[model samples]
Target: MSTAPETATHFRPVPVGLLRGRRPAVPGPAVPAGTGVEVRHPTRLNAMALDPSKIVGTAAADDGEPRGSGHPAGELFVVCDLFRTARVEIVPGSDEVTTTGHCSRPVLARHAASVMRELLGITDGLLVHTEGVDLPPHVGLGSSSATMASVAVAINELYGRPVEARRLIRFLVDNHGEEIDGRSDSLMPVQCIGGSAAAGLIPGSVQVVAGNAVPLLSAGLPADYRIVLAMPADPTEWDAQQSLQEEARHFDDFLRTGRRHAPDIAYRLIHQAWPALLEGEVREFGKLVFDYRFRMGSIKNCSFSHPRLLEFADAIEPAFTNGAADVLGLSSVGPLFFAVTRTEQKVTELFRDAGLRTFAARPWSEGYSVVKSW
Candidate 1:
């Protein structure tokens, strides 16, 4: 049995400048307002899952501030960057709600419309266009949440900014899940919601403390760190013909295990991982990250066990030996693997040598900055 440390009661914010890597410059001409608004949200890797009951919850969705749930809960995630982006464009005053994009998913567009209708209580004529780095549809990496977050930010911008940053995160958690469909698709999409959702929607590295109110803080890591994603070129798909009952059973079992194991999971995430990340202890941080992934993998139906992933891990083993990269682990519900490294060059070379598609991303510091406003 492992000893647990004191639970985190409050969030400690990190200085943005101290975080490693430059946020990639967003592209495209500035929005002139009347035409439309374009927004970019980053993809995330779940480092750990915090017990839900520990997260401070809002009395109601609209109240906005987080308060304790006063009961034990399960199903919250601690996330980091993969750096792939989901970009959305909203052109309001259309004839009806229309969504068009190269990489947009039907469920995502559906949720975006639903959120708009629920938030505004009306959706007569709104149009949303989304497209982004072609993220593998269902191998985790918080694609669903990222899509929803991109659309949410764009919609929030269209509506004259009624939802504040913190409140916006609550919106993404409203639903989350997935197997071949995605990670968050298994739950309410809440499990996939993390610092990436907050960062992309609001624009900063948000550390969500799952307690009474689910407190979120803007935290940063040292500038010397780097995140590299080893994404598989092709993703396998689940048969749509598979019985719904089987799927239900799979999810049910997964949830039950998470609940039963919540305490241990929560302790590692809040007590161990949090401090390592905060203080910039790279190897220790990586070890805790490995521990988190290992623990999650042990859960039935939750394992990301794949031969290709292991092969990739083996291929990148030398980086650890030479101290180019400090740690490596699976990215949330992934076929996408990640490595925490000392430099960007090491990450690039390793992936290039393996011939796997790679993406480089830094922790976002600004929660949500309007790139262009009319």
Candidate 2:
């Protein structure tokens, strides 16, 4: 459970190519027929749980209808080392697209085909395969976003990289509707751009401006720090539509009754947590994040819905207070808890003893990679 050997902080410029921009007039060079591409995209952990009220510039449009691409408020997230792989092969003369593995549903396959047809004007049959960690869906790991982004990246590559990662993200967000119900705010941009690691903005924060993820800080977390994830073995099956409805209610409630702790949460993030992370003060940063969660009344209410989850959280709270873990909090909606800890083994064991599935991951700064192409 001791700290791992210090690794050099990986720093690189955020890929401007992924920033919002107009699509190219002409596409990149076309690949040979039957071209194939495989991409590895990282999933993310919400360092600070999302609170709808805090989201800026993302209310109903002038027409009183929700915008197609919602703007996400400033939020911090870490791209974990866990990955989902997407392999796509273009099969000429075939009339249909087929998908297998993680997102193998017929509806999902049709969705993939629709994306390809719209983006690249390709009607060729696509043989798509995706795989990732055994984590349950809707556990705040950004699984759906990762899968969609990976497939999009692979398709883009097969077509000779004509589309920028940012445009792909924008397209995904704008087009997200009944096809995919549970979409994470800003997760597509993070995954498409290879996350904060690939963007070279580890331990930093981002806000979605006009559907683009703009980095608020470029600092990196201490390389030795680890993220310990505990996913419940039998998590409550969260319906995407139902969850969205709940969030909508929370947003409406926030608009009707403003959050009194908004300013405090913002101050802590911008002043305390940001500085702590910049100075490589892991414990201080973690404490600030853990504290930030409580300030958001919406998140607290959501957490209370799952009694067992609350019980588990109560059991693990002592680790953070006792200095064994730096940060301890839930990720997104529910049923998954993470700790920023030096003693990952101890934290992992604690979660497992509590009857949860546990795994320890390091913060990954780099984005997805095209591991293979043909």
Candidate 3:
């Protein structure tokens, strides 16, 4: 079949990381008087599911550390995709958790710490993670979200500021300085907003555009179908992320203004195209899929990509008889590409044959959580 690495679960790594062994669950930190305790939530690929290329921000949430003349107590935990999370230990004073693994854990941890510092309005002090998510790195998945969401769940518990799932997600949306540290909606919102009875009725369609980095995946995609996230083993860099922001400015205006820019308007139209796919409008939908991929192709990032995005389109462009692939896009600066194909067996075979790694997962519920609070 394939000659990829044997170590390559070549499948899902985030959740698998934890299966090998279990570390002691960490507890909440001690707090001072009158400080509001903070609790954290679980992590997911919420944003990526909507528009893989759009969810890139370099900010952390307020969960990892103490903040805003508030409570000193905080806690952290691992959420799902479920796996090897580094020993989640907290460094008080500074609000940040470290998720060290085989890949960019330490580096990501340090970056996450910085984001947490900013989000919580931390002035000088910093938070450090002695513990981390014990998982393989570089595989396309939401590891950063795991750490950040875990921190959020922990902080929420510590502060005693227990918010409803909607409220919790909204809090992150409003105050999230960046989506870089697992702030994407795929993690938490998928539970409340996905197949669950959270985001009202599932909309007719949910199309996320990578027009610019970090627009609104949950806001765009409808809740009808379960999410399928497929990632590879690479990521994007800082400069590319910035470029997405620039591209986003115009697209954001289009959404607000009800305007269209031919090429730019293509992906948005793809949103309109999805319902037709669900309703078995395969051929009609293929036209739109072609357009959407073309629109996204204008943008580029090193880590994440459609790889043979165009090639796939070419192969499947004419095969619209059986509810063909309705939508396909990259997960933010990714090598992690995703597609909503009607035929799983057929599509999976195609992907595997293409030498692309694949994983079979639906949207995860229970966004970032506090597994252990002492």
Model 2 CA deviation exceeding 4 Å by range: 1-34, 49-51, 54-69, 101-106, 177-212, 252-258
C-alpha lDDT values of all predictions = 0.49, 0.55, 0.33
Task: Indicate which candidate wins on lDDT.
Answer: 2
TM-score of candidate 1 on Cα atoms, chains taken together: 0.67
lDDT of 2 by residue, 1-374 (tens): 21111110111112111222223333523444347888887767766533334332332222442233333444456667787877888777785667755553334334544555555755667888888887656677756556666776677777776766554555544333222234322221111222322222223322212214434445556777788898777776654444444444344444322256556756766677767776778776676567765444434545533547666766777768888788777765556888877888888888888877888788666667879888
Clashes of 2: 6
- lDDT (Cα, tens digit) per residue for candidate 3, span 23-135: 11223232322232222322233222223222222122244431111111110111123332322334456533434344234443343344333333334333334234333
lDDT per residue, candidate 1, 1-374, as tens digits? 11111122221221111111111122222222344566666555655445422222222222343321122232322234443333334445653555654546645654565544455544445565556566555565666666667776776675566666655555455433222334322222122234445556533343543532234543565666667777667655542212122233344444544566677765765677667767766566566555544444422233333436656655765666567777666655566667767687877788769767887776555544445544
Could you tell me how far off, in angstroms, the CA of residue 274 lies in candidate 1 after the best superposition? 2.6
Name the better of 2 and 3 by TM-score.
Answer: 2
* Residue 364 alpha-carbon offset, candidate 1, angstroms: 2.1
Q: Which candidate order results from sorting by lDDT in descending order?
A: 2, 1, 3
Which runs of model 1 end up more than 4 angstroms from their true locations? 1-35, 51-95, 101-103, 176-196, 209-217, 238-262, 295-307, 310-323, 347-356
Give each model a TM-score.
0.67, 0.75, 0.46
Question: What is the C-alpha RMSD, rounded to one decimal, of candidate 3?
Answer: 13.6
Query: How many clashing pairs per prediction, in order?
Result: 36, 6, 70
TM-score of 2: 0.75
